[model samples]
Target chain A: MDWKRYLFIALIIIALFSVVIFVGKTQTPPLVIAMSMLATTLMVATPLTLGALSGVFCETSAVINIGIEGMMLAAAFFGWLAAIYMNTIFGYEPMPSLITGVVVAVLTGGIFGLLLAVLSITFKVDQIIGGTVVNMLAIGITGFLNRQLFFEKNSVFGGQVPHAPGTLPIIHLPVPKVVGGVCSLFTADGCPTFANALGKVFDQRPIAILAIVLVFVSHYVIFHTRWGLRTRAVGEHPRAADTVGINVTRVRYINVVIGGLLAGLGGAYFTLESVPSFEPLMTNGRGFIALAAMIFGNWTPIGSWAAALVFGAAQAMQINLQFFRDLIPPAWSFLQQSYIVGLTPYLLTMLILTGIVGKTVPPAADGQPYEK
Target chain B: MSENKRSFQDALSESPLVVPILAIFTSMVLGGIIIAWAGGNPVAAYIGLYQGAFGSLNALSETAVWATPYILAGLAVAFAFKGGLFNIGAEGQLALGAVAAAWVGYALPDLLGAELPRYLHLTLALGAGTLAGLIWGAIPGWLKAHTGGHEVINTIMMNYIALNMTSFLLNGVMKDPSPTNVIARTPLIAETARLGTLFAKYRVHWGFIMALVAAAIVWWLLERTTFGFEIRTVGANPDAAQYAGINVKRIITWTMAISGLLAGLAGAVEVTGLNYRHELGFSVGYGFDAIAIALLGKTHPLGVVLAALLFAAMRNGGTRMQFMTQIPVDIISVIQALILLFVAADAIIRYIYRLKASEDKLVLTRGWGG
Candidate 1:
């Protein structure tokens, strides 16, 4: 990595640690409390990172992809649907059900991505309108599907998938005693230790770690590979790229489709991985949050993941604080204002965007069509 | 050749008619299938929607009552979109307006320590609502013009500030002092300031007519005069408009203020005409739904009127459909979503219709740099 990029990352880590320490001191939280916060934060951060990474491809390719929330919601619904079907009619068991769920979810995301591509590229529709439509379409299709196929009467979807018997959940690792003590300081509660005291220090989810890997992979794919170079070139200057033999529209379509598939896979996490059952309108606004993170991260995969972590941490902190509201001061102790508390992530995002310098820049040709 | 000419004359159509009409029809058809798939008769559910909205005198009254605020809010969004601004803060502005109007409606009599004259009290309530909206809209407008801050970000931020402030007021400072009143709402308005029903027993009031009149005024403002021209010019391209000597920033600010005025009026009218007071649930998602209405209506005054009524039908019918079919009311939200999707992404619809793509397009944002 370049010295500047490394410096920027180190500064961010320092800032995050400083905030964590400051919050710890101010609240005088117990060690367990800190661990819970860290773990919760990682859980929240994983899907967010996945979604933002999904957003990176679409936004990078000049599609707004506002439909991320819808995509996630649809995928979650379908994933649950697959799981429910597996446990009921097929008797095919949970493992296969999860695989099917992931496949179906990715397919849904691809469909929506296709819609976005056709609208913005073929018809040259407004990206905002396209995004809004995606959100609404998702809401409508899901709501309609839930009512017709899932919500009412003892339907297949309302049932739960049985967990595979004898699945091992990691709790502890055999680490060298001295090194373990050092790692424990940064480690969050509920984290499975790595071998020989070389534990993952952050309160990290397995999916979150996967998401980090996806970010680096995405960065490499976008900036290093031939396709990545072409996609970036097309997005930045389609006319220039076209002259140099790049197919701008085709690249946008491919990238958007891949992004949708990733988002769809993320959707499965919410249903099959994060929680079991799917609720109506369950995705809430995570898609929009991801979109915001993508913007805040300036449309790079790794940057988007970093931004998602910040968002995840904020969400985790809110939940943790809610659980320990008693420790809060009486002046700010307005429990009924939980709705306002939930809005912390959004508020912080806007504040950061406004305050920070030169981060969150859009791709050069973002929201534009290549018409040559 | 002669027959072809005659056939062509018969086939002449208004340019924008087919798309929106088809979009609406397709949504209804899809909604019907959804209802049918849920084990409810599609026709029956639709009948319920129609009956709930316009079947009887009571339904008509309720429909009008619902349509009143929707029309006003729809106009608010449409007006701003015409001026090339997305006023997503309408929800916040509407809430503040309701709170302000509610304060005036109930607290004004107490501040004076006696019941005031009818016309004067009503005027005060409306003025407060309008002023609240004006201030809300102007802040972001001024910020956008002067500081080059995007209105989308500002409006979203304002929504947080406005909502939190409203919550604090409703929960703390301006909360009802009456021992019996535990709900987060203001006191009741005096009978004189309250808008009476036009029909003897119907809930429909003067505000429905007022909303219609407001729509007409919006139509006039956008199409008739020079200021409307300036607003349209700025909306079309502020840079080009500036080159043509228009005061772009001032127009932008004015457009937002006007939009906010209409939004505020939506809340005010609801308090005066339908609800008779502002409470927590008096205005819920009307402002946000107005965006859908504005878009489906194609951002025209007449279109907004039609779109508002259509949305009002779905919202009104949704309850009965749920009550009868055991389907959730969120189904209506789905159909509305479908309509928005079809209208916004006309490619699918266009492909289905086999229509040539229209050269004119809806460019909602100017991207980042432009």
Candidate 2:
């Protein structure tokens, strides 16, 4: 509705893009560099998109799922463990075994989500602490099980001989060369084969594609469906929803559980998709970053997708810091450390949360216990 | 619900410890089941755990050593809880404090080009560390006060920033430079800055004693002082506090600063009293453990002391438990989490134990938008 605001924002983003290109380009042909950056941004955005969607679902139903990190952790370990169990113990092929792993991961997340639901809803626990308990449980249980099942000699420390097993296969999509090829005609020398540009992005694995599809699906489901209305109603006013004959408890439980299922898929992305091996603390702080994205996006699925991509770009920028180093003069070598650039996403998150300009609205009933 | 008119003493007399005791018992029962499921005899493992925590003078002293940091961190969280704030940035605050104190301990002597007196040097080191934590904690507090930025998210973000910044600085500038030192740690503090061990061949130091005194001080401040009265009033109902002419915003900022100060003291004591140095890996989960301690202690000062000892015993004894029964030391973490779960949601404990609910229960952090 506000055309001026949209135009101004678009201009700013275009200006920022031009600045990045001007400062980053070198003798190495800018087109290839730019395409790879896009690919990496998509790569980093995959898990964050799923995590933010899960956050949106839970918060829309008035439950704050701070345990998303823990759920992802639990699902990550269990998913890999399931794969190991099926392939090594049961002697199954990778396809069936990987499916089983995905199922287990989803179920693990659902169970943890159920625990959070029971604690925060039925027992009326402090929601934040309840989520924290789930996180602690995930870490402790996974670590304890890791030692018993995987550690060599089952010793108190030192030996870490892990069991290797089968993994999921990646699905490469068709190249977007035809469209990219046309766009490159505008460039003076047709920098690189635009096919390489399109191919770089399409070479993504299965979960990455699913993340893109889920972003659209989640956006539509939240905005265009009857269930979305009930969720929002319950989040804003459970009493009013109840008066209107909606089952507030059932809606919250279903939404939160579904949220957990999405979180589990995000977790599996780490073990089954991102990398093959399951390491302790592998999920890292991505779950928290996803939370930040959710807040920054104002709890909307489409908005979260964009916010997550920005964060992903931030990380990608650091990983490909040679481009940034090219910006610095050769004489100022001391200022070109990658570590300093790695601070971007976190600092960006803090700045976003600080909201120097306007207030970001959160779900009204988030972290509150419903009283019948 | 009808007992609101009862005095505080009457309330205490009417089974104040029932929920916490029930929570502890329930968690232990759950933990026993877990241990049994893991193919170890729960009774033997617990017996071994008990022995390891208190079997000898060394075990008792080790438990005390663990409790030193736990008490300070727990009190920090507890103090914040009293003010209706969740100070999850304790981990960051602790690290900043440790690094600051280490810088003061080693660098100060060299910077002055003279050997400073023990009293002044130690105080200055600790004061600097506390000041660092105070400033770190105040930023989030200030943001929450002015911008309505949520402290929980800001604090967690600060944890990452603090940790990575500490890592970068440690590797670049403050890294131990001796041939044998490959790790990211600072050099040992000056002899004058190091705390004296309490006894021969024992690791416990004056820090343990200081922790107890600190607990007493927190108790007295919360219960006796007018400043604390204002804090409690603000925590209970900010609108009321504002109507009473109390500076609610200032109280919040001060509460967080003091909480950070306590956490900073924990780091400072750990450096001077036990390790005599700061490392990137030292005191990793003490801040998280402190939350459980604070909750398990019913957010009371003395209760925190006892709860810290309990947690410390479990942590200190975990190694022996693992050594004897081959159980993972993470069981302690599991049990601690269970305890927090039961404590945070006492309705489950009360239902299981068939205990009557008490009036005027403690409140944790407010919901979103509060």
Candidate 3:
């Protein structure tokens, strides 16, 4: 049944790719276009993949974290701010400053995660409302500080929006040699075009690659470790886990903080990796979309990654459509509208949620606060 | 007389409003601290806030104007709370309502090739918006009832879809055709379809009165009606309500529809009474703010109105506060979030104030499986 679902998703992705190729009207070969689209999909999916992983960790430990958006937003802002300060105030070089920014962003996310833990676990606030509070606080604090630090005339930076430190360097994988070696049996020229296209697909930034690595690492940690067993036990039945000498509160706290760290990394992807600058509400509901992906993936690490990929492909299609606006047929002129194209990911989320594919079952005690 | 006075003190201490008021006060204090930390005088900021919100007739009028939508949207969320459902889709429903109202406001008369009477045109436009919101809100309710889809995620998805759809329409077909205009907005509404102001010099319109009336009606519907009783029963314990032969599914759907209707009316009023055209970025975050208002109001109709007014005052005063103290208007959102936190988690307030637990506990919603 799971394989069938995966196959269905694969078919959809292929169909979406075919549409992009058909409407692209470029002289580039379909294979090269498809390769680039896959690359774009992976790049676009980086933040979502991290965010979904964040959800997976918290929810697996029975802490509902709707505050992932807030966490990401705060991380993005503080991370960017730290980078700027490091460059201007401390005279640190770009590479070290960016690394410091990433660290601060992760810590900021962890701090918020701890705050959420205190509110929901220690104070026993409703988890949903607690998450909402985090979100609102993030928005208010970020917006307020963004203005005072950069936009205001009496700001710390004297009203100048400092130049972005720089984006993370891409990890250049040696894909062309691998592709050329594989293609040597079929062609005399060793498939230079195929090598080049495949090479570009492998050229992604460190965080994007880290996101892919973390998916597997998280899957291993959640499914194959003693800690994973304890976490699941606490989530399903805290009293039972407690009777077995497992500290439920400790497990939940650790998992939630780990989730925050993941979300913080996702935030860093926005400022440090992708754009090198921060924008208000720039997470732009990706955290919510990541939550959807987590649920759609049935809260499994690999499943969520797969779901994130589909969403990423949808966004990639939208991005690709913008370049090929002139190529859209007269009858299908509506496809040229960026707003219409942007609806695909959200509409797809809704459709999946309607139980057409399959019902998603959350953990039994997913949102309940544990008591002694 | 001495015993009566003691009892009065006890009653005042026990009143539900105590926690909310204290929460607001604490949040304000914290906000002042934030302002001071940001190198602004907290006293001047608060003074400016008070003056901007209520210093003059014009200020009061602006507060009323802002409160109009907050009141309606707050009611939308509060009404859903009575039915054991969370209608986060109010934002989307409100947007669709505005779109529907704007379409009717600008296109209807032209389509009919005649001018409609002022009263009829206004009513039709408002009705169109309400119906659109009702439909938008009902879909998530129906999905939750029939298919076990969670409203939280669905509502968020619907928001994106509706927002994108709105952007598409505003950028394309619904765009103002005037040669000078390039913004993603509709043309001005017909004069007949417009809501009239209470005073020529003030922006306060009939919508403010309608919001007050709507609050009273919501109170009546919730307290003095059988359907309201059913909603409360379902909200308290769905299994018990089901055992009593209530159609839980229908109630949920209707609750969402009504909630959406109120949200839509908020948008409609904005279009017909104030903005006179539906534009992108207008009424942004009003729906989300309504959530905090609903929570702060303790999910009561009258409480919602009061909370809306408070929120409206803060929003209206924010500009003046910024002007006087150089504090960012965004501080209001932080304060509102704090208030919501204290209200939702009343244990903190109770602990701080050393108050005993009240009998009426707010059971917002159950976990995912529930």
- Writing each residue's lDDT as its tens digit, candidate 3 over A1-372 gives 277667767877887788889887466578887998899999999989999999999999999999998999999999989988887755646888898899999888998898888888887787888888888889878988888887778877887788667888999999999889989988899989989999999999999999999999999999999999898888888899999999899999999999999999999999999997888888988999999889888889999999999999999998887777888889888788888889889888888887788787887889999878
Model 3's number of clashes is 0
Better of 1 and 2 by lDDT: 2
Instruction: Summarize candidate 3's per-residue lDDT along B1-370 as a digit string, tens digits.
Output: 9999777756866898899999999899999999898889999999999999999999999999999999999999999988878777788888999999999999999999999999999999999999999999998888888887888888878888889989989998999999999899999999999999999999999999999999999999989999999888888888999999999988888888899999999999999999999999785687679889999999999899999999999999998999998888988888888888888888888788777666666778776775
User: Could you tell me the TM-score of chain B in model 1?
Assistant: 0.94
Which of candidates 2 and 3 reaches a greater DockQ? 3
Candidate order by DockQ, decreasing, is 3, 2, 1
- Top-TM-score structure, candidate number: 3
Clashing pairs in 2: none
lDDT of 1 at B304: 90
Segments in model 1 whose C-alpha atoms lie over 4 Å from true places: A1-36, A89-100, A148-151, A154-178, A181-203, A277-279, A330-340, B1-13, B108-113, B146-149, B153-193, B277-284, B321-329, B347-351, B354-356
Candidate 2: tens digits of C-alpha lDDT, residues B1-370: 5467355435543576877787888888888899888778898899889989999999999999999989999998899889888888888888988999888998899998999899888898888888878887888777777677777777777777888888887887888888899899999999888888899899999999999999999999999999999988888888899999998888888888898888888888888888888999686777678889999898899999999999999999888988888888888988988888888888777777655565566777876586
- DockQ (C-alpha based) per candidate is 0.45, 0.62, 0.75
Model 2 Cα lDDT, one tens digit per residue, A150-206: 663644323453344545675666566555557577876544577667678777777
Worst 10 residues of 3 chain B by lDDT: B353-362
Descending-TM-score candidate ranking = 3, 2, 1
Cα lDDT, model 2, residue A300 = 85
Superior candidate under TM-score, 1 versus 2? 2
